[model samples]
Target: MISAKLLRVLAPKIARRYSSECAKDGFTVTVIGAAGGVGQPLSLLLKLNPAISELRLHDLVDVPGVTADLSHVETSCKMVFFTGTDHSEAICGADVVVVPAGVPRKPGMSRSDLFTTNAQVVYDFAVVMAKTNPGAIAIIITNPVNSVVPVVCEVLQKAGKLDPRKILGCSTLDSVRANVFLGEATNTDPKNAYVPVVGGHSGPTIIPLWSRSNPKLCLTNKKLASLTKRVQEAGTQVVKAKEGKGSATLSTAYAASRLTYCVLRAMKGETNIVESCYVASDIYPGLKYLATPLLLGKNGVEKNLGLGTINDEEKKLFCGAVEELQKDIKTGEEFVKSKNVK
Candidate 1:
């Protein structure tokens, strides 16, 4: 018998309660590259999501054992796996197709350094997904999001099924990091911190809008600069910390899972569910894609809540990021274009 106090202590946090908004059926989510470091844990997290009906895992490598492992977990979500060269069947009727299928950043590598390998990796997956599940929300978590997003969009365009709104580059990890950091620095509950990170998700391109955060802080200029750098280079920081072993697998999985639920909530008719994503948006002057907090609903991106209350320093961050983001986008687009010509 559990004590009432213990039960009170054991109750889930508010973020987890978002899953309560759904108890519906037939909401399948397909995770590509499901046997990889991020994919395995992300699949496990989504397995625990009561909102997800059927959880499908797809990868080049055989993942039946991984599926078997998760199937034994005491969760209502059904586990299914698709392995070795055929991914379309797994993605066919999924409500959301999440792509975390790409090479990761090593200690000396920048996210752009991953482009040549991951570009084709993501493009191939997006080709199948674009043809198979055009209506489903495509949440991209492949690195160099600024680039791969545009590459996926090109696939959809070529397929004649382009819906810019549904193609989202998963940038929620930036927001997750920003919120927790702000919460710790200001002694506020991280859940309530709610930081909106904008720009692209790479190096100088990732911008955490500290001035716009809820329950704001009055940090000195030095503190603000440090915090900004921390958020921007957090992935590199993780790679270094791990001594080149891995890059942000666990936290990336958790953040991607969080966004997955947000998409699910919208599909199940929940309102006011917002999360940041890098998408094909003309929000900025010179960039085609940018990460902004979007109000998610049934059709995906019900409304894009524009960046709010940016300070001068934040503006400088955006300016510095534009050229890099543009180049990344071009690299992705050119990769697909070159393939098409070949």
Candidate 2:
């Protein structure tokens, strides 16, 4: 048996190894809607991460309560709350700003239907971010993300602070779902499965690049089609499963946190880190924006990794997805233009 002194001597070495595994470099993360369903859990995950040294919780309401609750979880990170009309203080010095502050979709509601209500909310928050954390990498988790991301860019543009590299629509949930469903179908471990999901975040627009997936599992044409459909409709499945009480809040939080972890790791200069996110794109030549593979770095978006070789059937799906995505992009642009005119 090891003596207490020997155990103490080995503890620091163990911690260093663990930190290396977890990539624990200090980062300050601000969760804009810290009181909401996704925000609360996302914040908790960040706080638990040894990589994060500080967590700033901001919300229009209940921030203090949320901060108080999360602060009790014994962790290395310090928690700070900025509540009620003081949005600027919360984002003032953040390295990363996560916006999960919007309403959920109802049974009969399309994501676009939540636009009028969420647009102003996201726009107002974006304005604050422009002034305070202008250089921070902004991860947008609000619904109608295709539109909301454009709205964020427009807001930053109006402030003359738009940086295409710094804004991303958090579509990692779609990628996560794709991997999970594919794993379930193949009876493979989800952690080992690598799937790339592109396009917009809403129904019919999400494109899973099954052909480009690593480990290249062969699926019958029928099974492949079924898997693709399952990935696209996964959100609706969760909604129906919940019987209209809530959407995919918990799973979304998990996915968002995973994406945030990748970004944070990349921000610390960890090399070869790649993740898919919806950002201003030039990948498909004429397409204005897309969710594609990106190399994240300390300066944000080291490189926009374009799509790999896709099969003929996949190309057809890609074309259809881009068409729907263009409409989503236009809807966001129009919303911002109207807001500006008003």
Candidate 3:
């Protein structure tokens, strides 16, 4: 973690790159993989958010049915559907574009295992996001986010529409898990629990800082370590329990919706709206991105609240996660380079 003095000096400087755009009313939101497991449930939750005025759903085959189903809900959110690969209409002018467009994991499959196919799927959706609404907040919920987020950044940068401030990889799930696990371990209410998860989104790369937990936890070292490991391995545990049927769709939808609401609420002028997200950052050396808590605002990231003070064990975990994330980010940048770096 960086010093508070240094963070105070640098946060706003990094934040200045984003637009100061604000919204007086509700905003238009688009879901690129609206028919998928995570997308369907996420769309339902977003439809219920009072901040969204329009919800655009797009997919290859089943989006119409999904959108039609969501439209029946008693909400003022206007619904639209776009079938197939042509996402120009659905994505255009959206206030926020969320891409959960990728295949999910099965039993015994690591997140990295889905990188081959999901990377390309996320890449395609990102292209449309860059082209149609470069200024909109782009939230990525695809698997292998440690890599695919860099892929999206690369694609948008190539298109001359890169805005590091607004492009976020929704790492909120790790934080959500951290909160729940911490709460459960401490025998406190989960809703009152809050933990800041740093590093990347998968495996050993997920670092949950117990020092920052709200309601203050006082667990033994053994218990703390076990809880941290549980948060990192939670996705795998879920996949195994599902017996090859699906991944963490329901929980992921809930997590992604939390992130989406943060962005929407920020855009609508909510102050001090902070969330942990994987976005372009200089919080840690040698890695272009890390999941750090950020102060959200009208435009996007108003300030990066760098990882606060962590314990010896937390630092050790963070170091290892950083090393792994460096490779993960390279995997993403390399993919983009191979495809479009002319």
Candidate 4:
């Protein structure tokens, strides 16, 4: 017996109430290397994220202490810890699983050098996720992401749980670094500088598209090359600066959290959330996986959003990146094949 005018007003209110309830439905995030330098800070960031209703910390050692320390935070998010064989418990029912569990990169070492050990670590985690939380969006922060991402993908495929959109290699760090470095050179705030970095996660495979940078920067070819090189070697620079004690943990955590937030927002049905991630794609011929900007959504990456406009120099760099990136990807595929991880 409601009037038409009353029904119109009530309908909008009901819709708003439903939206709020959906937003509060509780998101669970699991961190695989929760005791390491990257994991500790990454957990802190996840703890502070309002979208995450539960945070699961997993590691081989010292996870209990890390969990206890984070429990002191005033956030409403509940914290849990799992160690050793119980890592599977931490992963089950997770909405997002982040893998930063591996050996830290030392000075003078490329991400590829950490391959053999990290590949196995990432592989084991992928196996667990495929079995326990196959639908979860995986954000892999392990080194040699170009390869490790492929490793995870192949494992998931074997389990018949592969969703290309749900598995992502967190190459947002490269984009974050590009923004900061370009900000320094251009005297603009890094927050305002949007640089789309596409390619793989290491060395020449990291392609920073200066031509597509927001506010449109015009630099000489020499200057452009220098900035791109800096973005590519930025991790090495950080490793050396730390005197081989650590790699880029702080910045990496920030970037990973940024990407995680994007995923969470997308899960809440927020639209147009775009970020760079290394993911499986047929965008470029031959290479099965590469980093590019993706439009995130409720199910993870909704659109591939292939590389935007690039000039001659950038195109040449991209061609070279694809060649080297393919080799790294093959290495990962072969590693999984060797394990016979079905």
Clashing pairs in 3: none
Tens digits of per-residue lDDT for model 1, 1-342? 434464334333423655764565658999999999899988877877778789999998868988998887665778889998878898898889988998889977856578888988888887887778888898899988889999989888888888888998999999999999999998998888978899988878889988888878899978998998999889888989999899999999989988888888887888899899998887878788889989998888888887777889999988888898889889888888998822
lDDT of each: 0.85, 0.82, 0.85, 0.87
Alpha-carbon runs more than 4 Å astray in model 1: 1-15
What TM-score would every model get versus the actual structure?
0.94, 0.91, 0.91, 0.92
Q: Is candidate 1 or candidate 4 better by lDDT?
A: 4
Question: Taking the tens digit of each residue's C-alpha lDDT, what string does model 2 give over 203-249?
Answer: 77788888877657589877888888888888898888989898899
Clash totals, every prediction:
0, 0, 0, 0
RMSD of 1: 3.2
For model 4, residues 212-317, the per-residue Cα lDDT tens digits are 8875777899989998999998988889899979999999998898898888878888777899999999999999998999999989989999888888999999
90: Cα error in model 4, Å: 0.9
**Candidate 3, superposed: residue stretches over 4 Å from native:** 1-24
What tens-digit string does per-residue lDDT give for candidate 3 at 238-292? 9889888889999999898888887876787768788999999998889898899
